[model samples]
Target chain A: MTRVYLDNNATTIVDPKVYDVMSPFFCQMYGNPNSLHSFGSETHPALRTAMNQLYKGLNASDDDDIIVTSCATESNNWVLKAVYFDKILNGDKNHIIISEVEHPAIYSTCKWLETLGVKVTYLPVNHDGIVEAHTVKDFITDKTALVSIMWANNETGAIFPIKEIAQICKEKNVLFHTDGVQAVGKIKVDVQDVEVDFLSFSAHKFHGPKGVGGLYIKNSQELSALLHGGEHMGGRRSGTLNVAGIVGMGLAMELANDAIEYENKEVRRLRDKLEDALLQIPKTFVVTSRDKRTPNTMLISIKGVEGEAMLWDLNKAGIAASTGSACASEDLEANPVLMAVGADKELAHTAIRLSLSRFTTEDEIDYTIDVFKKAVIRLREISGSYAE
Target chain B: MAKNDLIGGSIWEEYSNKVAELMNNPKHRGRFTQEEADSKGFKLIVADFGAESCGDAVRLYWLVNPNGDIIENAKYESFGCGTAIASSDMMVELCIGKSVDEAVKITNLDVEMALRDSPDIPAVPPQKMHCSVMAYDVIKKAASLYKGVDMASFEQEIIVCECARVSLSTIKEVIRLNDLKTVEDITNYTKAGAFCKSCIKPGGHEDREYYLVDILRETREEMEKDKLLQNANTVFGGGTVAFNDMTIVQKIKAIESIIDENIRPMLVMDGGNIEILDVKDSGSHTDVYIRYLGACSGCASSSTGTLFAIENVLKAKLDNALRVFPV
Candidate 1:
């Protein structure tokens, strides 16, 4: 069976080159990046090289800083919590703003902070999932501490106006953080270009290891450390670094960057063709913003069947897809993001996310279309949700 | 491979056949026709919690000989699972010679206890116990009908499972399905509201509505005692926990064991847990671990419900620490 993986927004296959670069670090080059001995010192160069590669990949100049963390989740929590914690202690800022469609890693953390007496303002997004610059401007108060938004939605692949939002934050002298986990490899992300104060990315989102990620804090800013332990990442992040994971992430990033042009063009073409073919099926609705979306993502909501049931049927037919946010797939609760954009509860349940990658092929798409067409037809018959 | 082979060649085949035999015996299964019940003096009742998936109901047949001569040799039919069908088989064996009135006294608790002899039923006692209660209620109803009394007239005295608060009519309506032998089977047929906990068998606990016998007196007393909150208009079913209901705690614990030992570890591998906290006796929490034993621990969707379920249950039963964990 030629398995078609169309859930790249959830995770991706680790590139073989990334694996080759990481193999030595796992065994022969196994040493704590924090250690001072020759054994550790040998691995230190590789770790530094990885960090430097990432720094360059994101267009960070000599004055920029990068902090290595465990994953995008840790980076998000660290950045959001650190800002709030620093503001509280420094007696300078207290308010935090975020888009309603931010990932749970950011939204949930900010929501969690509200329980601690921190004030947070959730700015709503338009139907296209773009946060208006005015909403950002309106929400920023003198007490505003930070504005965190995701660069690209993991579900709809809708691109938020990060550059505009970042500009507003800069004008107001507020720290800007963008969860670039979904945007980094699929789309070009230059933190300097966007003027983002902090940017977070995970390796596994782009064919690197799962447990490793990166946090970029512009070198000019003096940020507080998130984890307290043996000094690593220049005392910005603590604990021994995941040398193998870091190295893999660096290689993955470099490869992803090199393949961006070709993959983007190819994936977008295939994605559009698949979307058009799928939409030709009766009562199917496209979920991604037509003009502005990640090249690799296409979300569809079949009118009459549950997204989950269809996913299972497709899985049996060798085409893997997802419904709504991966975090809330089995919730039975409709997608809050879909709801935020005014999607009906039933439509939210019917929504299916089909994210592609450079590896996705034409035959795979054709097979998926065939499999999905049958699954949806069968599910529709059993679903008994047809309108009169 | 060897393990599956062992089960396939030995235990699995026998278990499947036994379940099949019980399930296939339709002459003895389903709602007993009026003539059949009069002849055999028994009926099969299956209550399904439809809102929940799989088994969440009390499904076992009853031997209702209203005149008190239980049919000692009556056969049963079940199409659900080994435990449910076996429970039906066991119910017939336990109550056959006993009178219908005597059978009315039988509970799902009894059927689950009877199931202790059979290991293939997955041994979820709370749900099995519910099955027992459902069987008891059906037999009692059938016995009342045989005696020219309307069982529906006494709604207050007939408590289904105290934890579930399912009514006799609810059970009757739920169990009217044809091919139910397991709680999960009932769920498929009826869609009973078993969201918060297991609805597999009917024995766990009953969530009874509080209706004062002396309404005026109780009202005056409540007003005099200034305990107005106790008499608030909460829904009359299985949502709230009763302070005096000790069995509910046991049921919750049993559910915890099933989730922890059978369902949770898989969710944990995906980083989730159905946790309970603030277990109020000492203001401490109990961290139960359900080590996923099958191919499910690594499944992605398992963790989706793991934390929320634990938190929801704990929030209902306990007071704190119902937050998400790193699992």
Candidate 2:
């Protein structure tokens, strides 16, 4: 059976072209970018090229404004904690604002900061999983240090109004950070257009190799480094540079940038076909709103059939899917993103996430719809809660 | 290639092969209809159990004989994850062809171990162990319905750890069999107080009735009592030793030897040491005054339970009328 991988939001397969661009850096051009030698000097140009590629992909103002990190998690951690640590030194700001449906990287870090006596306000989202700009505006105060929200939710795929929210933060003179890990490559992200002070994106979320991501700081905002070591990336983040992974990320961003139009058209059409077919099944409803979400994501719930059981059956039929955020699925807890959107416990437990990629084909979408319908029907047959 | 490879790779290796097989195609994963029970001449017993933490529920169906002992057929319906389905299926299979009494004896560990691919490794992840606990609870519910007893009767065995579903008897048995030294040892052996850690001691994230610290202390006391009883029997016969007939010096010597032999080591293990302060013969009863030093002075159990235990040991070894007083 041909495998249909629909869980692109978790991680995507590395593009073969990106792999080919990175293979040579593993052995031939291996050098520590910080070393003062020819081997290191040879790596500076490649690093500069990768930096320029990322700046273009993110539409950043300056190529030197981006700091390469391990992944989006490190970028998010650095942005949140660095701002709070700076506030501690200055002793002026004490409050931080964030959305409820943020990834654990932001949510959990803010929770940890709360134990250190830092005040935090978790702005609630509406039933469509959209965080309103007015909510962030209302929570702003003289002591508010920053406002951090996600560009697109990993679970429901609901896109927040980042541009409007960033404008609100600008009016209030508060820093704004958006976790653009899911939205940067799938959609067009121009840091100048949004005016977000900080933005984070991971390579692995697109078609790049893992362990390399970028953080865009507009106007070269100075924040304390989370990882301190030898002077690398102007000492903003320190460690040996992942040359091969960074090279792959640059090539992947270039490819993703070139394919954005085709993705918005072809990928969106295929996702809509899958979503429409899935909605036709009995007792199934799409969880996220159609207008304010990513083009490739469809979160749906088939009432009375458990999401995990459905995912297992889908896996058995050679289709890969998920029951919302993969990081939070290890436990039996219902999806908090679903609950934040006003879904009851039963609906949250029954929700499944299907995220497509630019590489997904029309035939794969059709096959996935057929297999998903059968799995839902079969699981409902054995389920005691499903009637008729 | 394996069919699991079609999904890209096999993360299912985290689960046992038997668990994966049973979770995919459960054998006893349907409702047992009353019509089917009527044709088989068996009374149907249906019991429902729900886990509030995870919102998972399981309904167990048992076809018991009219005399209400043997379970002839069993079926289940689970409204949860793959682990719940596999556990409920295994629970049904274990209940069939057994007497109601025998079926009720099956613990959650029994059901979990039966699903394990090997003896040492767990069949499912630690967080998923509660699925098996739900299955075990449904069995007791069904058994109560069959025998027309209160569901509370089935819960007579006290549960010390709710997270791991460890009973007080199981904790005590593990403590005695392996001579578990600390609360950490109990967690390593029986997995009690491993997750959430509210059951490890008091003042945790939640309240629990029986913490592992309390269980370990109580079990160690019981073991010590048994050892003292054995020592008393060997040193003194069935005949009562008359403490009044001896001089005060002899009484002090005998009490000192007993304390040195039996109780000192136990107290020292818990970072405490006890010293005998004074003893007075009050004609009708012997008054023994003792003082607790070191960590015991600040310990909460030192004043009440530890003092009572010391009195019991002295009473059992010497005269029944001897009293213990903390100075």
Candidate 3:
């Protein structure tokens, strides 16, 4: 059975270059990165080179700090908790600003702060899932601690004006954080141009091993440590380093940055074709922002069928897709993002998210389109009088 | 994207065509109406007896002469469903030459037996019995008005199927409809005791050997009790609670009536509508079912709406019961 995997936004296949670079560290150089021994020293050079790759990709100054963590979720949690608590206790700021559609890692954590007496003002996103620059500026008050937004929506791939939002935040003297997990490798995201105080990235989203991601801290304001422990990420987070994962992630970032422009064109073309072919099927509609989108993502709603049923049919035909955010699938709630876009319950439940990768072939896209079309026909026949 | 690619044949088009055809059919989904009636005695100068309960088992109106003979013609009117209306028409046809006592003895069982050969009138619930009893009341009333006759001392009251709220008068009217032959026939045609088996006989037979007079007296007592309960339900306002089907007061009246009328007669007839199942509360709902007896087991639609109706009425009356499911 030939499976055409398209849910890259959930997680991508590991790159061979990343694998090759990290392979030796698993055995010959198994020493902890925190250790001062020769084995550890051997791994440090690779880690430095990986950081250099990120620095160039982000256009960061030589002194900009990069602290690694498990994944983008952890990076987000660390920023929200660290920044909010630090300002509340030390900087005397109690109000926080965030976009309405920030990923749960940022939005949910900030919501939790309300119980602790911290007031959060969530800036609204336009129908396209983009928060206006002025909206962020208006939300920033004298007591505002931070403003957090997303670089690109994971479900719709709608990119926000992060640089403009960040510049406005800078002018207002409020901290800015951007969850760049969807934008990092898929788009040319230069954090220096955006000038955000913090940006989150995960390795697994761009063809590296999971359980390894980082936050870019660009300013001189010291962040409170998320973990209390001995020498690891300069005591910022505890536990011995996931040496192999970190090495693979460093290698993945370098490779993603080097060929990003060409890869962007290839995936965007494939993505557009898939979207067009899918919409050609009866009763299918694209749910993402069309003119501006992440090069590799397409979310569509198929009328008269449940998304889970369609997923099962597609899975049988060896095509991988998602209903919405992968995290929301655990409880089987309708996608909140689709709901925010004013989709009715039926449309929200019927949405299928197909995310392409740099290596996805045109042939696979065509095969998926054929399978998708057939599945919709078969499902409608089974449903009988239940029409959407 | 191109609009040309979006055009195609789909199942929705097929459904639209089917709907057009369905609209032309006579039995096409729509509302239908029916009228029903049940009354008491007949006329002439021959044979008269105590027929207070007879009218409830048969549905028709009758007039009697000074000497107890049935009068050839009598005026009749009824307000009920289609079968009940047809049952009233059938009663007039069946009793033109019968004596007043003979007409009084006639049950819904006899009317349906006559209707077996009549193709125009569909067999219905034994509401004819109640109509027959009502006919007897009118005849007695008219006789009293004309000749100053007093017969209150001879009157008897009875209750039959409790779940259906059937009384001796009610049963006589049902019998006048001429559809029900046995207790189970009542269950099938009228939805009586189908939910809880309070009226049905135990072993699938009508148990006709039981004395009708004793059952009638017992039912009278039960009716009095149910009247009280019904009044209580009215006072409390018959609203089903969030987790219950019938209100507490409604359930009380229903259960009381069922036990006194439906269950007692079946027991006397050497059969019974036995309690078989009780469903624990599920979520905010509850359900229950009872065993059918006499002829009720063979009833087709009794298993559907009739069953639910009994359960629902009881649940509403017994507000705490939640919901009822048949087993």
Candidate 4:
């Protein structure tokens, strides 16, 4: 069967150009970038190019710090735990605020922090899966250490008002952190423009290698280090660096930024076509409309069919999709994103997220339309939920 | 190569082939209309059951030969995950050609076994096991509709832990067979309170009338009491003595175990607890003397409801003459 890949929000396929650039770093120029020997000094020019590529990709100022880590999870954990060390322990500010629809890295971290005398306030989202700035304003106080929210939701793809919330955090003299795992390559992200203190991103979410990620810190802020060792990344994050992964991720960011127009034009067009054809099915509703969400994501729910069963049907047809974040798929709980958006429990189980990429073709979208419709129709008839 | 290799291979590997096959091509997934049943000259029975844990529901259809009280055909409509669809298909397959009374004997265990690729392997993961349990529940709903009996009539056994389908008898039998000591031993042997842990102790996700802590204490007491009776009988000749004939040592042991297992946990939750000082068998009654600890001693209502609860547990478990007095 000719497979159609649609679950890009979970992870994207590594670009061939990135693979080509990384292959030489493994055997030919394999040396520790931190070593003083010439064998290591030979990799300096490439490492410098890679680091500069990341800085230009996210449009971070040269004076800011972009410490590379293993993945976005590591970056997110560093931001939350570092803020806990900096402001919560030494000062009277024991409070932190975050959105209810954050990824598990942010959500579960905040939950774990509550056990250590940290007061966490989970800000609820509206029916469209949006967290407003005024709501954050209502919760902020002198004792609040940080306001951490996501730039875009992985499940619903609903983009938040990061700029406005960053402004509020600045006025309240609180640090702002945005998880940019889903937003970096899928939409426009400029660290200088948004003015967020910290932004965490992963490489694999935007056609990069799996093992490398970066955290952008504005103006070299005084956040505590998560890993204390050798002076790698200016003593912020330590340990030996993954040289090949860093090189591939840097080039991948450059390529993804170069393809932003193609993502907005071609990828969005294909996603809209798939969404329109699916909406023709009975009892289907999108979680957030196209204008409010990222251009490449469509989170739809069919009335009486469960999400995992839909994935099974799509899997049989060689089509890939997701119920929500792939990390939470093993869990049998209802989709928390949909529940936070005021959806009933029944509707929460029916959420299916279909994300597109720049590599998605028109033929694949048409084939998905046919397979998804047939699967939903057959399952509905079996469930006796077909209105007709 | 699996098609789900795009991200990872966790969920695709969790489902068995039978689940994937039936989820895509469910052969017995439809409802029989009344007209179709009338044309076949068979009685039509429709039954619906919904799982409150997940939003899954299943409606069972049985075409019964009323003369013989046999089901000629069976079909189902399952609204759940892939596991539920396959489990329902397997459930309906087992129902065909069985008599109404015999079909009611079908259990969730039987449904899950029928859906398995092999006898030794499970059809679904532990989380999705509730779907097959739902499949079994819908069968009982259909049987009740066929015989015009209440659905609760088939549920005679007490369910101690609903998550793993471990009944009260099953738990007691496992404990006795293994001579289990702690609640952890009972969990490993019977898998009763592992899933949600609500069935393990006093307060958890939901309120339960039966708990593993109390059951373990009760069964251990019975075992010890049986041993003590055997020893006493051996010292004399072969004879039997009922509850009232039990010695004061045996009586005190029972009262203390009951107090710690059933009563103390509740009191400890309120930052208060009770300590049993002694058990005195008076001429007219047996009295259990206890001292209140922490805030329970200063509270006025502890003498009334608190005393009644302790006495109620002791009397129900040991002897009717037992009374609790907080000194």
lDDT of the candidates, in the order given: 0.65, 0.83, 0.63, 0.85
Cα lDDT tens digits for candidate 4, A66-115: 98999999999999998898889877789999998889899999999999
Model 2 Cα lDDT, one tens digit per residue, A127-199: 7878988999999999999999999999878899999999999999999999999897788888988999999
Off by over 4 Å in 3: A325-334, A384-388, B1-327
Query: Each model's DockQ?
Result: 0.02, 0.19, 0.01, 0.20
What lDDT score goes with residue B108 in model 1?
Answer: 56
Q: Model 3 chain A, poorest ten-residue lDDT window?
A: A325-334
Q: Which residue runs does candidate 1 get wrong by more than 4 Å?
A: A325-332, B1-327
In order of the candidates, what TM-score does chain B achieve? 0.34, 0.55, 0.28, 0.60
Which scores higher on TM-score, 2 or 4? 4
Q: Using TM-score as the measure, what is the rank order of every candidate, best first? A: 4, 2, 1, 3
Q: What TM-score would every model get versus the actual structure?
A: 0.60, 0.79, 0.54, 0.81
Give the DockQ ranking, best first: 4, 2, 1, 3
Give the candidate number with the greatest TM-score. 4
Per-residue lDDT tens digits for candidate 2, residues B189-282, read 9888765466788765345688889888988999988865664554455444466665676578678877987888889999898898999998
Off by over 4 Å in 4: A325-331, B1-9, B51-53, B161-164, B172-184, B193-327
Model 2: residue B255 alpha-carbon error in angstroms: 25
Determine which window of 10 residues in candidate 1 chain A has minimal summed lDDT. A325-334
